[model samples]
Target chain A: MIEVKDLRFVYPNGVEALRGVSLKIEDGEFVAIMGQNGAGKTTLVKHFNGLLKPTKGDVYVDGVNTKDVSVATLARKVGYVFQNPDHQLFCESVEQEVAFALKNFGFDQETIEKRVSWALQLLGLTQYRQVSPFMLSGGERKRVALASVLAWDPKVVILDEPTIGQDYAQKEKLRQFIMQLRTQKKTVVIVTHDVEFVAECQPRIILMKNGKIVADGSAKEILTNPEVLLQASVIPPQITQTFHYLKDIGLPTNVIDVYEARETILEFLGETKK
Target chain B: MRFMVARESVEVIKTEKLTFTYAGRNEPSIRDVGLSIEKGEFVILTGPSGCGKTTLCRCFNGLIPHFYQGKLEGEVIVAGLKVNEHPTYELACHVGLVFQNPENQLFALSVEKDVAFGLENLGLPREEIRKRVDWAMKVAGVYELKDRAPYELSGGQQQRVAIASVLAMRPEVIVLDEPTSFLDPLGAKRIFEDIYKLNQKLGITVILVEHRLDLAAKYATRVIVMNDGRVLLDGDPREVLSLEKTRLLGVGIPKATRLYQLLKNDGIPLKSGKVPLTPEEAAEAIKEAFKSD
Candidate 1:
C-alpha cells in the first residue's frame, strides 16, 4: 500500500533527517520502525501521509505520488496519530474530538455519529463522551487521538509511539486494537522504541540508524539480535535478553515475548523434570 | 580542620489537606491530599493520567495558585516556606519544575542560552551564571550541544537541554512530570539515569512523575500511586509494586515482576528474598526454581 524510492528529507534549517531511504509496505502489512532519538524514524513516516514531502525522492501510496497528494487528501487513506496527543487535541468534548475527523471528511451526520460512537466505544471513551478532553488524563487523551483516526477507518493506520505512556493493561488493549486492525486487512505502521510491544505485536521490524534503514526483518530476527538492537540504540526486551543469556547454559531459547519465554523455560524445566 | 555533617532526613516538602480546583472547574483537580518528602529522597509520582498527579506536583513549586488560576484550600510547605505564601519567581530558585513537553520549556535559540535562562533570571552575576550554566550542562551531558538551536535538536536532546536548564538553577527539589514521554525506551532510560545521578551527586530531592515504571521504578526509593486525584498507594517501590491494586489500576508493572508473579501463581516461585526488579534477578530466581535434581 506504501512505496518509497530513494526518499530523502531535510528540514528547512538544513538538517537532513532521512537519506536515501527506500521501503515498500504491502497491503495489510504491520511494520514497526525502531531507532534511537533523531534516527529519522519520525521524518520517514511523515512521508507516508504526505505530512513531509521528500526532499530528494518519491513516496507513493497506492501508485499515486505523495508530491501530487495534499495532506488533506492523503488523510482519507492514511490516518496518522502523533506522539503527543496534546498537539492534536483541541476539541472541548471527547465525543466531538473523535467526530472532528469525520465531520471534516464531509461524511453525513448519521455516518459521522455512527463511526464516532463505534470508535469511542471501542477505545472505552463512551463514558466520558460529554466530558471535556482537557479534564481527561494523558492516557485517555491519547486514546482519543487514536479514536479520532480509527473513526475515519482509513486504509493505512500509522501510530507514532502509541504505547509510550501506557501501562501493561493499556498496552495490551492497544495490542488487541492493532490486531483488530490487521484482521480488517488494514496496513499498520508504528514508529516506536517499545521493544516489548513490538514483540507482542510481532510486526515486521525496520531498524534505522543515522537516517538510514540499517536492518529490516521479522521481530524474532531483529528484536532477538542484541547487536542490531544495540547499534540502533535500543535495548532488547528484558525477557529476550534473559533467554538469550541462557543460550549458553544449554536451554534452547529464542523467545521474544514474555509468554513464550515463560512457556519455553517451563517446558525445558519440565522435560528435565528438575 | 573543623568537620560538619549534613542534616539527615530534613523535611523539604510537607502538605496538609491540600486541595486545588482549576478556574471555572466545579470539581477539584486534586483533593485533600497530604504528603511529605525529605531533602534527599527520590520519589516517583504516578497514577492513571488525569488522576491529579500533575496538580499535586504543581503544588510543590507554587504553580497551583501562582501561575494556574485555581482555588487553593490547603497548606503546602516546600523548603521551609509556605508554597501559597511565596511568589513563583521566589520559589523557582527552590524548586525546578520541568514540564512534560520539552518544546514548551525550551524557547531560547541556543541550548546554552536556555540553560542560562534560569540562572540569569535569578539576577546572578554574569560570571556566576556562566559557571553554573557550564556545570549544569556538563552534569546533564549537554555541554557539547551548547551551540545547537533547541528547535533543531531531537526529542531526547531537547529533553536533556530542558533538564540542564532546570539543573542550572540548583534547586533543592526538581519536579519532572513525565519528562521522558516523548522519548524512546533507550532515551528514557538515559534521562532517568541523569536524574538519578543528580539526586545522588547534588543531594537534590527528585520527584519524578512518570508512568514508565519498568524503567524508572528501580531508581525511585518511593513510588506514590494516585487514582481519582487521591493518593492510593505510597511506599517503597518493591512493596508498592507488588500490590494488586497497582496492577489493577492499569499501571504497567515491570516485566520481571510480572514474570515473577506468573511463576509464583503457577506454584513455581522464585527463591528470592524480595521481588526481582530486573530481568537478571528474575533469571536468577528462575534458575533457582529449576535447579538440577
Candidate 2:
C-alpha cells in the first residue's frame, strides 16, 4: 500500500529528519515504527499522506507518487493522527468533528451524516455525539480525532503515539479498536515507544534510531534483542524480560505476551515434576 | 555506620479535610483528602486516567486556587506555609512542580539559562545563581548539555533540564506530574532514576503522579492510588501492588510480578508474597525456585 525510495527530508532550518529511508508496506500489514524522540518517525509518516514533500527521493502510495497527488485527495486514502489530541480536535461537537472530513471531501449532508454515525459507532463514541469536543477527557478527545479520520474510510491509518497519556483501560480499548481496523483490511502504522502496548498488539516492528532503520522483524524477534533495544533507547516489554530470566534458568524463551508467559512457566514446572 | 536521622523525623507537608471543586463542575475534583509527606519521602500517586491525580498535585503547589478559579476548602500546609493563603509564586519557592509536557514548561534559549531563570527571579546573587546552576545541572545529570539549546535536546534531556531548572530553586518538595508520559521507555527510566537519586541522595521530597505502574512499582517507597477524586489505596509499594483489586481497578501489575504469580500458582514452591519488582530480582527468584525444586 505504501512505498518509499531513498526518501530524505530536511527541514528548512537544516535539520535532517529522514535520510535515504526506503521501505515498502503491503496492504493490510500492521507496521509499528519504534524510536526515541527525534528519530524522524513523525517526519516519515507525514510523507505518506502528502503533508510533507520529500526534499529528495519519492513516496508512492498505491503506485501514485505523493508529489503528484493533492493532500486532500491523498487524505482520503491515507489518514494521519497527531500525538496531541488538542491539536487535531477543533469541532464544537463530537458528531461534527467526525463529519468535518467527509463534508470537506465533498460528500453530501446525508452521506456525511451516515459516515459520521458509522465512525462514532466504530470508535464507541456514539453516546458522546452531543458533547462538546473540549468537554471530553483526553482519551475521548483522541477517539474523536481518530473518528474524524476513520469516518473518511481511509485505506491506511497512521497513528503517532496513540497510547501516550492513556491509562490501562483506555490503552486496551484503543488496541481493540486498532485490531478491528485490521479486520477491515486497512494498513495500520503506529509510531510509539509504549513497549508493552507494542507487545500486546504483536504488529510487525520496525525499529528506528538516529534517522535510520536499526531492526525490522516480528515483535518477538525485535523485542527479545536487548542490545538493539537498548541502543535504540527502547525498553523491551516486561514479559519479555521475564522470559529472558526464565531462559537463564534453562526455560524456553518462546513467550511473547504476559498470559502466554504464565502458561509457559506453568507447563515447564509440570514437565519438571513429571 | 553513621546512621542519619530517618526522613520521617522531619515533616514537610500536611493536609487536613481538603476538598476542591472546579467552578461550574458539580463533582469535586478532590474530596475530603488527608495526606502527609515527610521531609524526603518519595510517593507515587497513580490511578486510572482522569481520576483527579493532576488536580491533587495542583492543590499541593497552590495552583488550585491561586492560578485556577475553584472552590477551595480545608487547609494545605507546605513547608510550614499554608497554600490556601499564599500566592503561587510565594509557594513556588518551597514547592517546585514539573508538569507533564516539557515543551509547555521550558521558555529559555539555552539549558544553562533555563536552569538559572528561576534563581534569577528569586533575586539571588550572581555567584549564587552560578553555583546553584552548576549544582542543579550536576544533580539532574545535564551538565554536559548546558550550552545546547533546550529545543535541540531530546525529550529525556529536555525533561532533565526541566528538573534542573526546578532544582536550582532548591525547593523542599518536587512534584513531577507525568514527566515521562511524553518520553520513550528508556527516557522514562532515566527520569525515574533521576527522581530516585534526588530523593535518596539530596533528601528532596518527591511526589510523582504517573500511570506507568511497572516503573513506579520499582521506585516509589509509598504508593497512593486515587480514583473519583478520592484516595483509593495508600501504603507501601508492595502492599498496594499486591492487592487483587489492583487489576480490577485497571492498574496493571509489573510484568515480573505477573510471571511470579503464575509460578506460585503452578506450585513452583517459590515464596508467596508481593512479586519482585525488577528483572534482576525476578531472575534471582527463578534460580531459587529451581534450587528448591
Candidate 3:
C-alpha cells in the first residue's frame, strides 16, 4: 500500500511541482494518474520511491516514511520504469540488464538467473537475450527496461508513460501483462495520457491539474463526467464521447468500453424497431 | 480549355524497387517497396515497430546509403534529384526529416539560433535567414519562445521549435516520425493541427509517420500501411482504414471507424455507409440514423 499526506514539493528552481495533494492506494490496486504535461504527475510519483523528498507533509511506502528511507532502500519494494527507456538502460546485453537489479538486491546467482530468464520470457525478449540492448528497436528497448524492473519482483510497480512508443500489438500484450500482475496481487500505478488504453484497463482514475488532484474515482465515474475531465484536460474515450452525444436519444452517458457501447446501441436499435 | 484551370499534379517523391540492407544485417530493412507521392499531398505512413518505417523515411533524405553505411539497391528520386546521386545536404533543402525526439534535432542554445542553424549552413544572406527564422517561428506558433533555451521549454514547446527549425529551410517536403509520442492528447492534437495548417496553407507535401490514428486520420489525404518491410495498404483514408486487412495488420483503426465496423458487423447500418473517422462524424451519422427512423 502507498499513501500521501497533504504532500507539497518545491523544486530548487522555485517550481512548486506538487501542492497539498493527498491520496492512498490499497494493496493490489491498479491506479492511473493522468493530466497535462506540467500537471505534476511525475513529481507526485517520484515521491513514492523517495526520488523527490516532500517539501511539506509526508509520503509512506509500505508503512515506512519515505523521508526516513533512502531511494535504494525503497527500490527493493518499488520498481520504477522511467518514461524514456534510454535513460534507464545501460547494460551491454538484454540478459545482463535484467539481472543487474536482482544482483543489486543481494539475490543469489541461481535466483537471479531464474528471475532474469522469467522476466525475459515474460516480455518476449528471450530471443534477444544475448543481443546488445542498444541494437534493439525503440519499442524492444522499452520492453527490456520493463523486464529489468519486473525481474526484481517489487511489490509496487510504477510505470511512467508505458505506451509512449509502443504499437497496437505491444499495447495489447502490455495490457495482458498488467492483468497478470493483478492476479499476483502486485500494486500497479501508471502515469499516462493514452486514454484508449486506460479505458480498456479501467483502473481507478486520478486526475491532476496544476499540482493538485482534481478528481479521483472509478474509470466510469471520472471518464464519463466531461466537466471534471475537461478541468484536468483529459479527453474522454471515443466510445464515451459517442454515448455522450447519444444521450438525447436515450443512451446512457457512462459507457466507456466499446463492446458495452455496441451492446447498448444494439439493444436500443432492437427497441426502436418495435 | 479544361487544362487551363486544372492544377498540374507533379510527383515529388518516387521509389522503384527500393531495397536497403544495413551493414552487418542478414535481411533487408525495407524490401522492394515502390510508391509515388504527389506534391502537396498529406500522407500518413504507419506500421508496427521495426517494420521499416524509419528505414524508408531515411531513404527520403539520402541517409541510408550515405550516412548509415548501408547496402542500398533501388531507385529513389526526390524533388527531381536521385537520392543516391546527390548528397544529403543537397536533399536537405528539399526534404526535411524531423526525427521522433526533438532534442536530437535541436542543438543551438536558443530557439531562434536553432531555427537559423540550417539556413546558416546553406550560406544564405543574414537578412534572408533572419526573415525566414521569424516567419517559421510564427508559423510553428513558437515566436514568443524564441529567446528561451531549448532545454527550458516543455515537451510541446520543444517539438514546436524543432518544427520551426525544419520549416525555416522552406523544404518542399516534410517527414515527421512519430512526433507526438511524448506529448499528452491535447498537446498531440495541437501539434497535429499545426502540421495540418502547414500542409493546407503552404502546400508542403507531408509524410507523417505516426501510430495515433484517431487524432491523425481526419487530416490525412492518403494513408499508407507497411508491414514486414512491405507496403500492405495505400489509398484514401476511408477506404484504407475501413478494410479488415489493415486492422489484422495491427494498425490502430480510428475509434470512430471501429465503432462503425462493430455496428456494421452486428447487422446494423449507419446513415452514412462510409466509416466515420472522428467522433463528431460518428455522432452525426448516429443522429441521422435515429432521425430517419
Candidate 4:
C-alpha cells in the first residue's frame, strides 16, 4: 500500500509542482493519473520511490516513510519507468539491460538470468536479446525499458506515458502486460494522457491540474465526463465519444471501452456482435 | 540539375527520387521519396517511429546535408533553391523546422530571448527583432510568459515558445515534427488550433509530422503515410485514412474512421461517400445512415 498525506513539493527553481495533494493506493490496485502537461503527476509519483521527497507532509510506502529511505533502498519496492526510454537505458545489450537492476538488488546469478529471460520473453524482446537497445525502434526501446524494470519484480510499478508513439497493436500488447502485472498482485500506477488506453485498462482515474487533485473516480465516470477531461486537455476515449454519438439511436450511452462500443453498434445494426 | 531555378514556380518545395542514408548506418532513412508542396498547404505526415518522417523534414530545411553527416541521392528543391547547394542559414529564410522536443530547440535563458534568437541570427536590427518577437509571441499565445526562463515553463508553454521562435523568422514554410509529443490530447488540440490559425490567417505552408491522427487528421488537407522508409499512402485525409493498407501498416486511423469501419463491417451504410474524420462529422453521418430507425 502507498499513502501520501498532504504532500507538497517545490523544485529548486521555485516551481510548486505538487500543492497539498493527498491520496492512497491499496495493494495490487491499478491507478491511472491523468492530467495536462505540468500537472504534478510525475512529481507526485516520484515520492513513491524516494526520487523526490516532499517539502511538506509525508509518503509511506509499505509502512516505511519515504523520507527515511534512500532511492536505491526503495528500488526493491517501487519501479519507475520514465516517459522517455532513452533517458534510462545505458547497457550495451538488451539482456544486460534487464539484468542490471536485478543484479544490483543482490539477486544471485541464476535468479537474475531467469528473471531477465522471463521479462524479455514477456515483452516480446526475446529475439533481440543480444542486440543493442540503441538500435531498436521507439516501441521496442519502450518495451526494453519496461522489461528491465519488470525483471526485478518490484512490489509497485509506475509507468509514465507508456503509450506514446505506440501503434494500435502495440498498445493492445501493453494492455495485456498491465493486466499480467495485476495478476502478479503488484501495484500498478500509470501517468499518461492516452485516455483510450486508460479506458481500456479501466483503472481508477486521478485527474490533476496546477499542482492539485481535481477529480478521482472510476474510468467510466471520469472519462465519460468529457467536459471535466477537456478542461485539463484530456479527450475521452474514442469509443465513449462514439457512444455519445449513438445516444440518439437508443444504443447504450455509458460505454467506455471498444468491446462494449462494438457490441452496442453491432446490436444496433441487428447483427450479433462477435 | 538546375534545382536552384531562376524562374518563378508554383511549388514551394519539391523532391524527386530522394534517398538519404545516415552516416555509419547501413540502410537508407528515406527511400526514393517523391514529394511536392504548394505555397499554402497543411500536410500531416505520420508513420511509426523510425519511418524516416523526421529525416524527410530535415531535407526540406537543408539540415540533411548541412548538419547531419549523410549521403544524399536525388534532388530536393525548396523555394526554388537546391538543398544540397544552399546553406542551412539561407534555407532558414524559406523554411523553419520545429523539432519534437522543445528543450532540444530552446537555448536562450528567457522565452523572449529564445523567440528573438532566429531574427537576431539573420542580422535583423534590434527594433525589427523586438517587433517580430512581440508579434510572434502574441501569435503563439506565449506573450505573458516572455519574461520567464524556458525551463520554468510547462511542456505546452515551452512548445508555444518554440513555435514562436520559428515564427519570428517569418519563413515561407514551417515544418513541425510532432511538436506536441509532450502534451496531453487537449493541449495538443490547442496547439494544433494555433498552427491551423497560422495556416489560415497567414497562409504559411505547414507540414506537421504527427501520430495522433484522431486529433490532427481533421486539420489536415492532405495526409502522407509512410512505413519502412517509403510512402505507403498519400491523398486526401479521408481517402488515405480509409485504405485497408493504411491500417495494416500500423498507422493510427482516426477513431471516427474506426467507428465508420465498424459500422460498415456490421453492414450499416454510410450516408456520405467520404469517411468522417471528426466526431461531429461522424455523428452527422451516423444519424443520416440510421434515419429509418
- The numbered model that scores best in lDDT is 3
Candidate 3 regions exceeding 4 Å error are B1-5, B288-293
Can you tell me which runs of candidate 4 are displaced by over 4 Å? Answer: A91-96, A109-140, A269-274, B1-9
Q: By the DockQ metric, which is better: model 1 or model 4?
A: 1
Pull out the clashing pairs in model 2: none
Scored by TM-score, the top model is 3
| Reproduced native contacts, each prediction | 0.56, 0.71, 0.57, 0.56
DockQ of 4: 0.54
Query: In order, what lDDT does every prediction score?
Result: 0.87, 0.85, 0.90, 0.87
Winner of 3 and 4 under DockQ: 3
User: B1-293, model 1: which lDDT tens digit per residue?
Assistant: 98788666889999989889998778898888999899889999888767898889888888878889978998999999998899988888899988877988889989999999877778999999999999999999999999999988888889999988888888999999888877777888899998999999889999998876777888888999998778889999888888888889977777777777777777874686878778777777787766764
Candidate 4 RMSD to the correct structure? 4.0
Docking class of 3: medium
Worst 10 residues of 4 chain B by lDDT: B1-10
| Residue A74 lDDT, candidate 1, scale 0-100 | 98
State the DockQ of every prediction: 0.59, 0.67, 0.68, 0.54
DockQ-wise, the better of 1 and 2 is 2
Report the C-alpha lDDT of model 3 over B119-209, residue by residue, as the tens digit. Answer: 9999999999999999999999999999989988877899999999989999999999999887777788899999999999999999999
What lDDT tens digits, residue by residue, belong to model 4 across residues B176-283? Answer: 987877788877878999999999999899999887777888889999988889888888989999888888777778777877877777767677677888777777
lDDT of 2 by residue, B174-197 (tens): 999888878888889888988998
